[model samples]
Target: MTTLTTPTAARLAGITRTLSEWQTADWKGFLHPGDLGWNSMAGAEKSAADLRCWTADGTVVAIGMFDGEDLFRMAMDPAALDDDELARQIEADLTSGRVLPAGTVTVEARGALALRKRLRARGWNEGEPWTPLRLDLRTPVPAHPRDAALRVEEIGLDQADDWISVHWSAFKGTPPSSDDRRRLVHRWTTMATGPFAHLAHHLIGYDNTDQPVAVTTVWTAGDGRPGLIEPMGVHGAHHGNGYGTAITLAGARVLQQHSASAAVVVAENSTAGALATYLAAGFTASEPVTDLIGSVTQRHP
Candidate 1:
């Protein structure tokens, strides 16, 4: 039987660490270590509380989390993708509503999953397309990419406002609260000594006026492994100035310095401009990943 378990607060960190260990660059469109890191940094208490896992003979074979009432994000063991019994069990569990709440649910399964088709057969519609992009870091990054006019530098607590302001401007309506910022800094501080020490990088790009215009946060899975640049953005006013590419190059440089094998980022296939920015930053595009959506089949307590 496939056993399901909700890891407790004490076990959450270790669970994510194990998931990170399970991550490999070759596996595309799956749950990622940096995804866990991002959620943890954003709201550790809430994230830990929402995580769940499926085990086979006591070994965790699948990991998942609910982003709210409607969306579920998951990644399973690459080995188990071909396991018919396991995949059927997973599909049943998910649709049964024992694990997820009833709703018009959306599921993002990283990489290709066998369960995807089963969900489709059960009335799930294929959702939006997302493209993954990568930059090789095995070779030295050019000290300067062509459009390097913006001054980019690594930042810390003292310059949090610089980073936050650009982030707030980029994300306009959904900006984080003051308390969220405090927790983020605290999370960074706590990561100082672990394997995650070299994982997170915060960078800010400045315009000619010395005002922060762009920001990027890169997280390396481990030395010589793939690193991800999540939410790299340019200030609203600075959107057309090439700041996005400059900041992205800056992020890739940071990953290279930290021994990353490659730098990765994902963009929606529909976002032509954003995709163009990453391509301009020298990232190669890959096949797009699609989400699976379906209404809950039952209700869970």
Candidate 2:
């Protein structure tokens, strides 16, 4: 029997695993295991509650996770994408508030060009474009051209506050509270004991005075697979000091050490500075992906 249901926390592992298996280089920058890992490890309790799954005969064929109320990041097995019956069923559920409420919303689907075209015909418009870049790690990554003056360290429980502080400083926002950092530390620590522990790493880069000035989180899909540097940033005070490239290279090294064939990252097409940093770190750009935005409305059979 095929059914729709909200996944409980216990079922998160299965969902993330299925998503990882479906990921291919062709679907690079789409939803993947690392996205879920980052969510779970960073203690995205609220977003976790929003996860939805479509299962057929005890197997998950489709999954969706909300980045926020109006933006749903999702993917489906390629077979389901080609199955007319399942495609219609998914459309019905999404429009009837079974997946999300009625309103304007966006869905980023991997290899769903047909669905995107259909939605566009129904008054939906294309959302912003995102560029996915990758660095080949099949061979050893060359050392940075600049001297290695900065020091990078793997983040641990004791460095939770420092890590959070660096992130907030980079984004210029209200800092995460001590309680929030504690939750993140707990989640990361708990994940370390789990089956997927080998695929994740959190690193912080410190300046000469021993102040944390940059942070990054890297995730791999196991050896010889493509890895990701989902969130990498340098503190605002340290922006011009080459910390961005320094920390990004550090993240790539972590992934390479784990035997990843390549390191990948996605950023808004408009984020010129970020794109430049990755390019400087030895990454080459790949084809861009677009997000599809539409109002929740009935689609005729």
Candidate 3:
């Protein structure tokens, strides 16, 4: 029998453990352990509050997290990909207004074929697409002469401010306020100190002038499974200097050293430049995946 429940503090660790075990070399648009770490930017308590899990015989079979009030992202255990009953239960909860509110909502379940089929049969439309790119790390990464001018460092707590500065400047295009700095620091600290901290690497790239020009965080499920590079960015003022590719390669190298089978990243299909950067770093693109968009009111019985 299958059951659905939100994890408590004791179960949170188990949920993360199950998520880590779900990662595989074959690219799937599934929810990643890194996604949870990145979402911890809001705080672990809030992340737990928004997460739901489906279990069979005391083992997790599926996991979902609400991205804000409207987007519900999920991943199913690959072994249960064809479990129709589980898919139906997931769809029911999604449209029943108990998990998400009663209105239009987006579901990202690219790897969940059974769930996707159910949503399509119910008339859900496809949303925007995202491109997944991956680099096999069985071989050593090629070194670039140009990257010699950039220094990549694996950061610790003391360098949290520098990490926050580059992240805000790269993504927000503005200087971070005191409150913003505090929040970003807390986010980094929470992940750095969490149960899966050993699986994470926080990296920042510096130019010849010693200015922080790029930043990224990499997470690995374990050896033989693909690692993830989430939230990679170049400082807004330094966009044209090849920093994005350099920083990406830096992140990939960390994963390689850590014994990850490959490094994977996803970018919005509309962001041609971001896709280009990953390509330049030797990541091959895979088929793009789109979210399913639907209104709760239109759900079929």
Best by lDDT: 3
- For candidate 1, lDDT tens digit of each residue in 1-301? 7998787667765676667666576757567666766666434556666677999987888889877678888878878876778879888888888887887889888564678877878778988899988888888664445345788899766776667778877878355688967765565544433333345788999887888889988987777677888878888887788788888989999888887888898899888878998898788988988889888857976
In the range 81-117, model 2's lDDT, one tens digit per residue, is: 6665666677667766677666788888746655655
Best-performing candidate as measured by TM-score: 3
Better of 2 and 3 by TM-score: 3
The reply for model 3, stretches above 4 Å from the true place, is 298-301
The list of candidate 1 runs beyond 4 A from truth reads 142-147, 173-198
lDDT of every model, 2 decimals? 0.77, 0.76, 0.86
What lDDT does model 2 reach?
Answer: 0.76
Candidate 2 error regions (>4 Å): 41-48, 78-84, 173-198, 297-301
Candidate number that wins on TM-score, 1 or 3: 3
> How displaced is residue 114 in candidate 1, in Å?
0.8
* Residue pairs in candidate 3 whose N, alpha carbon or C atoms collide under 3 angstroms: none
In model 2, the number of clashes is: 0
